[model samples]
Target: MTNEQLQIRVEQISHDFFKKPFIHKAYFNNRLRTTGGRYVLKTHNIEFNPKHYEMYGLDELDGIIKHELCHYHLHIGGRGYKHADADFKNLLRTVGGSRYCRSVKPEPVRTPARYMMLCQNCGMKYMRKRRMDTSKYVCGRCKGPLKLYKMEEANGTQG
Candidate 1:
């Protein structure tokens, strides 16, 4: 939804659920990666992640709006507004807000090791995803010289 619709929705939810009028702005913040929404303490504005609405629909978006409104109302009323506070928790529960937002994306995959280093004296092995200089580095165990080898060569694979 657009910022205007979001502002209207937030204001409506605040009035309907908290019995308070939300005077500040509410908008979608595309830069938000991990949070569903945030209540700005300084500006009293609320920012939402558009991805949440796109992925989970209006029900989830309403839950997020409710969660942020809890912070907004409590902070304005000069009460504890943090998640750990009793007032915030109680308000959130009363409004049936979500405690945590669902993940939007999966964890990134790790790249395979492309290079291996062997210590001549201590027999220590090290794996790395990128090439490193062997002339300046030494083994931690024995201060031995390190020999860099391609991972395929170390694995006995000729290419």
Candidate 2:
């Protein structure tokens, strides 16, 4: 749906469920890859991942919206709005919001490593399962200093 449509939906849901008005913007954010939705503390705006709605449909989207709305309303009402807080949990449960913003299934892990750290002086490369500390270690070849030259996580795998 369009951003305007989403705004309307969020406002409608807020009034219907929480008996509060959602006075901020609500829209799809393509850059939101992992999170289903997020409520910005600064702007009180809500951003939803369009991919979530495309993949999981309306029910899942609604749950995500409700989850964000819980944060929005609680924060505005001057209550404990963090996920770990009792007030947040209670309101979320009452409204049937998702406990966590659902994560999209990440891309597959490659065989050996998802990132590669390279030496600046010797051009020696080290493939790593996780992010390597460049400051701590040096290259095996020539004992040269290392730098994070190539990050392969974005291309073929999700790290």
Best by lDDT: 1
lDDT tens digits, residues 73-141, model 1?
999999999999999999999999999999898688989999999999988999999999999999989
The weakest ten consecutive residues by lDDT in model 1 span: 150-159
TM-score of 1: 0.75
Model 1: lDDT of residue 105: 82
Candidate 2 residue pairs in backbone clash: none
Model 2 backbone overlap count:
0
User: Per-model C-alpha lDDT, please?
Assistant: 0.93, 0.86
The sequence of per-residue lDDT tens digits that candidate 2 reaches over residues 36-153 is 9988999999999998888888889899999999999999999999999999999999999888655687779767676787778977768877877799988787888887644654
Q: How accurate is candidate 2 locally (lDDT)?
A: 0.86
TM-scores for all candidates: the values are 0.75, 0.67
